[model samples]
Target: MIQSIQYSLDVIQDEARQLVQKGVVSRQQPIYVLCNYIPAREWGWVESELEKSDFLLRDRIGDLISHENWEND
Candidate 1:
């Protein structure tokens, strides 16, 4: 489950950064704006899991929220 969340976050961040780099959006914008572009099917479970335990997730990831591949990166 954690792996799935990490994967979704990675893709979301990558696409978000690309959009920012292209001037399509600003880095200061909320990430939820770019989330619509991500596949809902793949992210649905992750979103549910996050909602179920938002605090636990935050504790698990800590300050690595913006880091890609939390296990290795």
Candidate 2:
């Protein structure tokens, strides 16, 4: 058997808003700070924070590195 669940836009939006308010999803400033100012020694801590905020830092960094390599080659 297969099951499917559907959510209404208002429900989805409300859930997303709650996540943002709870720090489970982050705003742009935090992401920018992580990108620009995170120290090497604090990478693990920063990565943990990003994970908690539902950011796929490892996968995103991998993609960015690949793109940069491709651009240079």
Candidate 3:
């Protein structure tokens, strides 16, 4: 579970940096501009901005499942 969250955070940060670099997001503003107000969900969206990006998220999740995944499952 910890691993999953860590990977997701990593991908989100990577994507956020990319967005800032591309001018899609402003450095002075919060990441919520490109993503929703919710950091995790918005970060997840960032992970899926492109095709096969979903796989990027899934790869990070690995075999660790969490309460959130269970409730949604």
Candidate 4:
């Protein structure tokens, strides 16, 4: 059986960063798009965390992530 992983704000950010690294998602994309990338079973947890963190579906992925190398030079 697959163990369920909890999706906290930190985990969401980490996963977003990796997605950015993998070019699967860009920081400018809407947060809603993440549902397409994340497994359906876990997306609910992630979405809830985002909502609690004051994030909207239309919010940019960058809003969830912190300052990193992606910053404009």
Specify the highest-TM-score model's number. Answer: 4
What are the per-model numbers of colliding residue pairs? Answer: 0, 0, 0, 0
Could you say which candidate leads in lDDT? 4
Off by over 4 Å in 2: 27-73
Q: lDDT: which is higher, 3 or 4? A: 4
User: Which residues of candidate 1, in runs, are more than 4 Å off?
Assistant: 1-7, 39-73
lDDT score of residue 52 within candidate 2: 52
User: Candidate 4 residues 1-73, lDDT tens each?
Assistant: 9877779888888888899889999999988888887899998899888888788989998877873334577
Instruction: Go through the candidates in order and give each one's C-alpha lDDT.
Output: 0.49, 0.41, 0.43, 0.84
1-73: candidate 1 lDDT, tens digit per residue? 4343444444544665677677776655554454466566555655554454332232323222344433655
Write the residue-wise lDDT of candidate 3 on 1-73 in tens digits: 3333433545555655666667665655633454442366345545544223333332322211111222454
lDDT of candidate 4 at residue 25, scale 0 to 100: 94
Model 3 ranges with Cα > 4 A deviation: 1-7, 36-73
Q: List the candidates ranked by lDDT, beginning with the highest.
A: 4, 1, 3, 2
The TM-score, computed over Cα atoms with residue i paired to residue i, of candidate 4 is 0.80
Model 3 quality (TM-score) = 0.38
Error of 2 at 69 (Å): 44
Candidate 2 residue-wise lDDT at 45: 58
Q: Compare candidates 1 and 2 on TM-score and give the better one.
A: 1
In candidate 1 the C-alpha lDDT for residue 28 amounts to: 52
Query: Whole-model lDDT, candidate 3?
Result: 0.43
